[model samples]
Target: MIRITKSIISIFLLLSCFTTVVRAADFKPLPQWMKTAVFYQIYPQSFKDTNGDGIGDIQGIIEKLDYVKWLGCNVIWLNPCFESAFQDAGYDVINFYKVAHRYGTNDDLKRLFDEAHKRKMKVCLDLVAGHTSIESSWFKASQKNEKNAYSDRYIWTNDSTIKPEKFVSGKFERNGTYMKNFFDCQPALNYGYGQPDPKCPWEEPVTAEGPQSTRKELMNIMDYWMEMGCDGFRVDMAGSLVKKDPDLKETTNLWAEIRTHFQDKFPEGILLAEWGKPQQAIKVGFMMDFIIHLRNSGYDTMFFNKTGTYRRDTCYFDIKGNGSPDFFIKNLTTQLCAAGNDGYICIPTANHDFQRPCCGERNTVPQLKTVMTFLMNLPGIPLVYYGDEIGMRFIDGLPNKEGSQLTKGNRAGSRTPMQWDSSDNAGFSSGNNSSLYLPIDPSASRPTVEQEKKDPSSLLLFTKELIALRGKYAALGNRGEIKFLQSKDNQYPLIYERRLGKEAFIIVINPSGKDVSVSLDYDRVVQKVFPVLNSSKHKIIDYKNKQLKISAEPLSYGIFQIY
Candidate 1:
């Protein structure tokens, strides 16, 4: 009987072990789409190029799949890879089905999609449905005749009237025959078309008004891409879809309809909207993100000194335009509770189409990492930009005295080149040196993926480790109830605590010349503490007499687990 009982007990233990491993892999922390998703945005041309075309291609991305997976990112949000006339990145889509010959062929795209899925990572293509290249087949056909079947696919008004001086829409303008353009060279679509082109069903409006037209057009689009096995979309200018001529309410409704259709079809797919307005976007079930600058309130901001960090306000209750540390703590707590169901506040350090933070502005890695920790671990969802893992190279003023290429301080500046190795062209392309579109950064201190892999504390490794840590705790990611610890810190350091039910965390940041002492007595909720990652300038000293004291190197952050 004893031997039989022992065998049964051993079998039960085996089953328990198997279940634990499976649970970790099948961690469905968030709702259908977001659980276990770490999205990495790619600026294609700057990511890599092959065949000496001086432009990035689909094949270039395939070569770097291992590097992407190594970063622990399981979701890829690629910037536009469609055919275009090279204006405003690739927001202007020329062909929806075919891969741009310049980028590669259909076979290359198929291969890329296949490889991406094989690595257990999902791929989301940029869908610029709002407008198309004026050179697109449908647009060309529509422009041929005023009453063409494809004429009403876009928001076009052919009054031949010159635009008003300093009018409402300030995107861009061409001649007196100006069509509404988010940028120059992009003509707005006409409101309602009688029929759609044979190739494009979205060429014509379904009804006279835009609401019904948008519904039909967006549904058709969702059907095509989902059928092609796309995971979802990082929709471009989603807020601009409804057009301001009729006000944003109509546009916001269009988004709600668009979001619902995709959500119903690809229930487990991701949808990250680039809408700047969070209040309106969440209504339609979308995640809104920042451009380059992260919404921040550093303790250093309060100091009237060399450091530029903002000092937090005295009261933590108000969520207005107050950029205070206490304000951050309190408001973040409110966001944790409310923002998830309403809309997700995606805080990112920088993206491809924006100014690089490192251009001429000197801030240590610790200072940068501290900010990263604060943003990524906050209650709401965290969106990481492409090169933000490592300090990226930056160029200043479009017209510089150094004769280097001048970026518009918009998308062009950050869309330079990927520093993979210290190679001649940063391993971006194999073409001849002069054939390159953008010049390689010349600094020797440029951080490369190869070099960063060897260093555990490298910005790349640190980001990866931190991201993985977030995955470990379901409470840390998405949004939940958060509470900031009580403290009277007069510019000593930005210290606070975060709580989600029984789960609680402490955040401390030191962006100054001297180290400061951290005390648990500031809050009555002190218990045992365990340290997460901190910048090189900081260390976790022993908890002595209810006080944690250490010499924090400037621009440092500390994340602690309290039990």
Candidate 2:
């Protein structure tokens, strides 16, 4: 018995070593453009209105391409513009082949890709792969009483009476009940279950014909767009495809297949997953994934903790300075180690689903600038949501539109129309207030692009300056190596070194309302001070005895080059 146990241990050790070696060797180089790519996320319905119909459209996006380029973003992550029922925003896709009529035609979308590429920029469309609108033609054919090609396109129970969890029945004519992904309007596609139970005869294996057909259709849809100049996709709910995928083994394999297909056809096309788990997402073949507002991912702990998500109001960037970077740092290191050079972890200022950096207590320019400094200096790709660059406030109590109200919170606040200028509808549209898609910020002091563009010290200009600084130095870009140089006890006045070859820069941040100082080891450096971003006063107090002392004022940050 002892001998058998010893043999088992040996086998386990061998397998662990083999797994490590496989992971180390499996990483493929990311696209050349992705290394320095900065993404600008645009919610199409809120960006701009070309014909003054009150809803932002593809032509509007086309007209604003120059503005996007001017903002120093080389990639545009456009939210779903597909045909939809306007339920759950544009997430409940009705047709993958057509753009929503309210937005424009497919030709207009094609033109958007053309225009973006002409400006040396790329556009990534939002791909909602997990589910489709109940109004979709595929779902319509699937719900028919007779068996047809699309009869099994979506998941359905064996009998109408056998209603499983999250199942919807009695509305469709089909004899079997169907499963929903989120809302009643969105039905889950048949990607098949990772673990099919023998007792549940309705559960289909991943190798089933229905799932294979669905995979083929997904490939066809992607090919259709890529053939027409579309760059890539930001796959929504990427990990939510296969059912019962607790380990995500089957789901990863599914994406691996898709990755293989894309590599052969459109080698330069990228795939950014909304998986949130960077470790698993990178292994699943996504070029990038988000460190989003998941339970323990530490995103909320760093920025806005309005709902007490993770650690509550004690955000790392809060003026209170009550939050610690330990949680965020741990998660970040784990993901970075897993990713290595394979993929990037995108950290956005704010997305459509959450409050921007300028919301709530972090409304002041000094506070916003500190947050921007930390985010922009980080090692991975930086994503700036539409109005976040201009410090747009997240308005509360707005009426829900297109299913913006959810269990998480009312997303309508973040989905408000962009405040471009002081014109009618804030230059978003020429339509009357009643005809507008959503109400504009009623605050007279609400920041606008026009007003901020004229102010050199405005947050909008600061954001642009930060992006340009990032572009100016290789050590500040996405793939640069970063080393934290702060002392162990105090996490305030966060200090870090970004070095690539001979190019090195030290960045310091003090988010609290009170001043803070930190001592760092600088044995190998000569001090020649040049401030790249000094939002508030930052000074090198002393450089004596091989220890460099630096102090920053309240809510201030600075980037210094070491000579």
Candidate 3:
């Protein structure tokens, strides 16, 4: 008997050793403290105003850190605090090391980072390595002469006769005559800076191929920010990094190099790529972006990819005479969930460049709550848009223009300021309220944070609750497998099952109006139900007698436990 007991103990020790090695070799995730923690995204200009400069600054973020923490988020993903011309809301970065004077100094960022760490939250910086601002000194230097070292740092194409075949798809008029820019003035890096524009003669063509020196330069840019005490990088335009180029091996390899370099210093630096190609991108030791897959998969049946989606206020239908409501959100939500199945995702509802989701009431409180639950609860990292929590709407009253600003897309309404209070200027700053960076979201007062906190049903309060709930489950934020569950009703309601070892989560959401009833099949396991959401608490949310009946409210969701 004693010999048998010793044999069991020996096996246990062997298993423990194997498990420890596996854990260490694998990505040791950010502390579980961030698992159920929510992230509050802040657009420096809109979150709060420290000085009366009519702009939000780092001091303002520092001041509001407590409020953000109180909102139940341990991870904070700031849009872009780096110095920029404010074109595309600082996405067009000019300097990686320096914080823009408009936002604050390097000290302010240091202070903010310190404060966030004290709160036990993880912070990720938005890395815009995709493209630097055209006005950036690098571009300036490269454009100055065709012989400068900086000239080869950016992608500039010469050979005015050859056009990137993809560039001629109605978006740009190219008979190999005019050089097209992504945002007109913003020249797409020719991969090599000194190279003349492939369609023009002003600059020499430089292929994105760096041989070796250019990789060193990009490494320097990445190292600069990580050394500034950043926790991770959210690689921008990840898929676009190797675009229309026959040799994408060089670009993807560059990402692998960046991953290897930073992972050494910050072992868990959260290397998340915005690259949507999961098969290739995920294997490269970085997380993937997942929107294209969602729409195609039809997380919900009402929408047919982005094709079925259109604005509710002014939706035009095909001859079918019907429109899908916020079908795009299904794309976004399932995108996060699917990616979570593989790697991490930099999930944000609306960023600077795109039109805001809440423009002209794309979201109601119930709808917003459902979306928040979907966003935070889905696997991957949740990136909150600057003002999405309070249901900040956009205002596109301005006429479309032909210049640098977000003139065409529904961008004006999305970048609106945070509705801090019900006071004039939404308490963003003491500066002249009329001189806001972007116009105040029109329907803000009814759904403001102050009002939401008081009413449990408000969107702001719902956001706080969702973030808090996410903290309770480790699988929600990490490597959990997603099994898309089918709803009994084939209407707008879509359901999916998630299995993370012993923890199983059922997410049921309806992105459109019109109630639907469905039954869920949890054939295998008996469950232990825990409270993850506030709105709906159905005591027995598990399968009984081999069946689970679910009644979903219009434009709402219920998170369930199937232990």
Which model scores highest in TM-score? 2
What is the TM-score (0 to 1) of candidate 3?
A: 0.75
Error of 3 at 321 (Å): 14
Query: What is the TM-score (0 to 1) of candidate 2?
Result: 0.94
* C-alpha lDDT of all candidate models, in order: 0.57, 0.84, 0.57
Q: Provide TM-scores for the models.
A: 0.76, 0.94, 0.75
Candidate 2 regions exceeding 4 Å error are 1-28, 307-311, 428-437, 441-443, 522-524, 537-541
Q: Stretches of candidate 3 above 4 Å error? A: 1-37, 157-181, 190-211, 288-342, 355-363, 398-408, 428-436, 441-444, 475-477, 487-489, 520-522, 525-544
In candidate 1, which residue ranges exceed 4 Å CA deviation? 1-33, 165-178, 190-215, 245-248, 287-338, 398-410, 429-437, 484-492, 517-524, 535-553
- Order candidates by TM-score, high to low: 2, 1, 3
Q: Which of 1 and 3 is ahead in TM-score?
A: 1
Error of 3 at 490 (Å): 1.5
Tens-place lDDT digits, model 1, residues 1-563 = 99999999999888865653343233222244464566777877777776676677788888988788887777777888877765656767677766777788767876787898888877888877667776778666555444555655555333334343322222223212334446544655543333434443333443455436545766686677666667877877666554433334445445555656666666666666776545444544564443222233222232212111211232111112122455444444443344455445655555664444343333446545665665566655566666777766454333321112223233454566777777755655456532333555455567777778898777788788778777777657654345554364544456665666777666666655465565554433456777765555345544556665544455667777777
Q: Is 2 or 3 the stronger prediction by TM-score?
A: 2
For residues 1-563, write the lDDT of model 3, one tens digit per residue. 99999999999889965653343336434343333434566666777776777777888887777777787766777777888876566777788778989888988887887887887766777877656676788666655434676655554444335555322121222122222345533444444322234544424323334424555666686677667676776666664544343334445555656666776676756666655554445545564453432224322322121211222223311112134434544455555544443355545555555444454444456656666666666665566666677777655554332122433334444455677776656655355643555445455444567766788667777776666656666555545556656632353455666667887777777655665566766677565555455354443244667776666655657777666
Per-residue lDDT of model 2, residues 324-383, tens digit only = 887788798789888888889998988987777876677888888888888889888999
Best by lDDT: 2
Model 1 lowest lDDT segment of ten: 303-312
